[model samples]
Target: MQCRLVVNGFLSSSKFSEIYAWLKAAFEKRGHDMTVCTNIELAFEKTAVTEPILFWDKDVTLAKGLEAMGLRLFNSSRAIEYCDNKALTYIALKDKVPMPTTIPAPMTYRNIGYTHTEFVKKAGDLLGYPFVIKECFGSFGQQVYLAKEPSQAMSIVKNTREPLVFQKFIAESQGKDIRINVVGGKAQAAMLRRNEKDFRANITIGGKMEKYTPSAEEINIAEYVCDILGLDFGGVDLLIGSSGPLVCEVNSNAHFKNIYDCTNINIADKIAEHIEKCMDI
Candidate 1:
């Protein structure tokens, strides 16, 4: 099998570089010739799209271009776009999966910002204080915020100039969450993440991780999310709610190193094998 692992214009960080290395090695070990291609290297003049693509970037334009040339994208361009936007992810999986009450932030121009923030008041009224505010496109828990009071919530709204969301905060799941890696509509590896101080339980945000076995409900949520999103592989984040597991978010190109370190499970291997089967290698 010959394929190209497509990435963004930049590698972003060492974490992403490490993930690319692991994925490349995993496929190569399975007797496949994997070439790394950045979005910068894409050329429209090229023909012969014989090899499948393992797209690891969120550049929808590049992904779409590749697809237009008849190259198969592992998770598909639509899948990446759906998962890239937090509000869209909720909208797409609203009835399909259990999740916190989410309200998409009103549209705003980047220059003018949220000139009419009266909607913030409405969101505060509906979601209440201590609600979760997340920038629509963020990862590793960096753009997530907790507003403990209306003042704090309003302040967040006033400060943020990007698309965002107001969500019901699950207190029981504060500082704790579950990450389940799903490949080919199946849950492959799971981990529990907890932080004593922060509300976000992302390992990148100082959370502790431990290997975990997901319940049937949890597994269903994880697999269903991937299946519905048309993802070949994904990392599903779940909040342990009082009633059941509520989805926190989904990562199309989730970094598997943390899960590997915690569970000694190489999700890259699972992904490689799944891709092989998908492309019929």
Candidate 2:
């Protein structure tokens, strides 16, 4: 299997490389020819129309444009676009899973004749304090905020200059969350992310983790999310709210390194195997 991987802005665009070195090795271990490209034009020449394309970027060009060019993509462009946008992913899965009470506010969060207290001015009810505000395009919990008050929320809104959504702040979580990694519609691994001091519990935000097991019900919910998106792989983030596990977001390209380090799960190999199967099909 000869392959070319397209990455727009990589995990490390500088002196640090070896971001996808493991997968590259996996492909070569199976005797597949490989190439990595940042420029689509540079990659297009050697690529066969039907050959498998593994895209790590969100440019939509490699996934949509290449698929239109008759390339066999591991994950479709539709899946990437749907998952890339936090608002869309939430809307798509809100009804499918037990989800947080979410309200899509204006990107600017303007008064618009609404009182500062109303936040919506009569359009909608004010939601949880310390609201969870996520930017439209982000990853690794980089664009998340824990706004303890409306003033803080407004401040964040002013700074980001991007559309945002607010979800009920889950006190029970105590700045902790769960991430379930699914491959081929199966829950491969689960972990609990917690930070007693920080409001955001992303590992990148100094959140700590431990090897945690998921209940059968949790696994079932993760599977349901994967089925809803028709995605080959996913990392579903669930907030253990007062009710139960309420899904907050789903990521198309969940990094396996941390989960891989914490649990010693060979998730990369599983993803590699899954991609190989897609190529064969």
Candidate 3:
């Protein structure tokens, strides 16, 4: 199969570039032709939709445009959009999956910032203090925060000039979580991430990783989330709840280098195989 890998143009970090290179190599190993291109390249060029596009970036506009031109995308544009925004992800999976109680911050314009943060107090009343505040769009646990008091919560809300969400903080899962890599409706690999100094267990932020064998329930929840989100593949973060695993986040284009180091499982190979099976069908 002939394919193209679409990545973000603005992001030039080696972390992202390495993933693209590994994916390209995986596809080539399978005797499939794959080319890498940035969103900027495709945006300016009048390119024809000749082959399938493995969208590895979060540029939803370009993904949608390519879809409109009749090119098949591995994970559809709609799926990427839903996963790109934290509030949207919760809204999409609220009733279908088990997750922390989440409350979306009211919409506010960037020019006209929040005049009054009364909603933060209300959210505090519902979710209590020391809750989670996450920007709608972020990665690697950078935008996630913990507000220990109402004042801090209100301050964080007023300062952040973008869409965000309030979530109940699972103290039991603080500084630890599970990252499950799902492909083609299956949980292919998993890792336990723990941060000794921070609450966020993302490997990018000084978190430690070790191979993890997910429980049956955890795997089921992860796989079901991908199915509901219409994702061809994704990385599902699960917090260890008192009762069972709670869905923390679903990443449509999740970076897998850390998971590969932990589990010695190359998710790129799984993705390539899945795409080949899909194109065959």
Candidate 4:
């Protein structure tokens, strides 16, 4: 099958190159007509006739524009919309299985107010220190902060786009989180990221990763989370909380090589296989 794997950002970017190399080598080995390009430099006029396009982690705005121009996305446009928002995904799936806590932005300080702590300056008495303050729309470990006080949490909300969520800290979580790579509604690989010194659990930010096996419940939660969010393929972050497996976030265009090394699975190949399975060559 002819495939066009589109990626945002520069090819030299570590995150971009990591996935690109795997995809390039894998698809070429399979003899699929493949092309890769940055979002802005992509000349859709030429590619439209030769291949099927799959955009990586681009904002849905571009997808909408592409659709209007008669371009197609590997994942349906509607699914992309739902997967982009972490809060929405959490709200949608919280009832089905264990899910993270998130408080939306643009509210009074009193409604989502703060306190003081020596360990966590300007802390929020409610959410408490080490609680999470995530930007309404951020990915790749960016725009996520740990607030010990209400003031820090307030800053995160006041500085970012309206409607943010204050996630209650999972202290017993042991400064770690699990990310499951799922494709075609199946869990392919799992990695545990931990940084006891810091609050966040993303590998890019000084966190360590180790192979992990998800229990039946965690796997079920992984499948259910993505299925509910309408994700085609994504990295779902889960926490092994006291309750069970609690999903933290769903990354639509997840970076896979780091995960591949940790899990020893050729996720790029699986992605190609998935494409071949869903498409009529």
Candidate 5:
């Protein structure tokens, strides 16, 4: 079977490129023809799609267009949109899944910015000190921040001109979290990320990772989040809460290289196998 891989054109970092290469090679090893193209390359093309598209980028508009053209995407466009926005992910899984107490920042135009931050005070009052503030659309823990006071929270709101969320900080899970890579509704690999110097436990930001075995509840939550978001595969980050595991974040196109290094499981290969099962090829 022939397939096309769509990646972000602007992301030229070797970290991003490495994942793209591994995915391409994995598909080829499974006896499939894989062609890679940037989202920009197909952005204005008016041609109909002939084969499945392995969308590895967060370009939701392009993914949606391809889906409208009768082409199947591994993780559907809707799924990508839900996972792309931190607020939307919390909203979608609000009552169904265990997660941190998250409140969407009131809508504000980028031009106007936050005129008054009274809402930030309210959020701080509700969530308390040292809560989390995350930009709606971000990855690798870059846009996530911890506010130790109302002043800091308001500062974050004023400085950030994009959509965002206010979340209750899981004190127990500070500087640590679990990443479960789920494919085709199953948990394939799990890793524990630890960062002693930073609150965020992302590998890109100095977090160390080790292979982990997830609890049944953790695996179930991870799989259920994917199912709810209509994702064929995803990486679910879980905070080890005092009560149980709380959903930290979900990635529609999660990078698997760190998990691969920790677990020695090539998630790209599992993704290829899952795609074959999905397409019956």
Candidate 6:
């Protein structure tokens, strides 16, 4: 079998390179020929091929084009779009999965910014203090914030130009969260991320990781979330709320390097196998 691996050209980094190398090797080991292509490479192409695409980029336009060209993408363009924005992810899974009380921030034009503070106050009032504020489109937990007071929360909202969401912060889950990797409707590997010094438990933000065995319920929710979101493979971040597990976020193209370090699980291999099964290779 032969496949095209599509990624963003400008977003190249050491982490991305490493993951690409692993995935390429994994696919090759399974008797598959994987060719790495960037969005730029297909920018002017007016032809279509019969090979499947493993899209690793957030370039929705390019992904859609490829799909329309009769190519099957691993996660699909729709799934990637839904997971790219936190608010969209919340909306897509709110009814299908357990999640925090998430409210999309009121729309504000980038040029005008927040013209008033009333909406921010309203969000603060509803979510209460220590609420979670997250940029709709972000990664590595950098755009997530824990607003301790209404004033600070309002300030954070007023200063931002990007779309955001306000969520009920689960106090019990502070500094910790579980990341479950789901592939082909199955929970594959999971790890617990903890940051004693920060409320966010993202490994990129100095969080520690440990191999974790998820509960049956966690596994169910993780896989179900993927099924509903049309994700071929992803990482579901869940918070242990007082009542049960509440979804924190979902990653369409989830980074697996940290989880590999913790669990010694090469998710790339699982991904390759899943793709083979999916494509009937």
User: Which of the two candidates, 1 or 4, achieves a greater TM-score against the reference?
Assistant: 1
In angstroms, the error of model 6 at 29 is: 1.1
Sort all candidates by TM-score, best to worst: 5, 3, 6, 1, 2, 4
Model 6, total clashes: 0
Expressed as tens digits, the lDDT of each residue in 1-281 for candidate 3 is: 88999999999999999999999999999988998888999997626547999999888999998988888898899999999999999999998999999999999999988878998999999998799999999899999999999889988988889899999999999999999999999999999999999999998899999889999999999999999999999999999989889999999999988988888999999999999898883
> Which residue pairs come into collision in candidate 2?
130-147
Give residue 225's error in model 6 in angstroms: 0.3
Q: Which stretches of candidate 4 lie over 4 Å from their true place?
A: 9-12, 42-50, 68-72, 107-130, 159-163
Q: What is the lDDT of residue 255 in candidate 1?
A: 92
Q: Per-residue lDDT tens digits of candidate 4, residues 94-184?
A: 7777765665543335444323223222225555666887765677677777776566655555555444466777876756888898888
What is the C-alpha lDDT profile of model 1 across 89-181, one tens digit per residue? Answer: 999999889999999998898898887777888888998878999999999899999988877887888897999999999999999999999
The TM-score values for the models, in the order shown, are 0.97, 0.87, 0.98, 0.84, 0.98, 0.97
Better of 1 and 3 by TM-score: 3
lDDT at position 102, candidate 1: 100
Q: Over all chains combined, what TM-score does candidate 5 have?
A: 0.98
As for lDDT, the candidate ahead, 4 or 5, is 5
- Which 10 consecutive residues of model 6 have the lowest summed lDDT? 41-50
Tens digits of per-residue lDDT for model 2 on 1-281?
A: 77876666445643214446765776777777767666455355534445577766677655777877787665567778878887777788877789877777654443442223345322223665666777778777788777776667666665665666777777788778888999888999989999888777789879998898998878999889888877788788888877688887887767777888789886667767788777662
TM-score of 1: 0.97
Between candidates 2 and 5, the TM-score winner: 5
State the weakest 10-residue window (summed lDDT) of model 4: 114-123
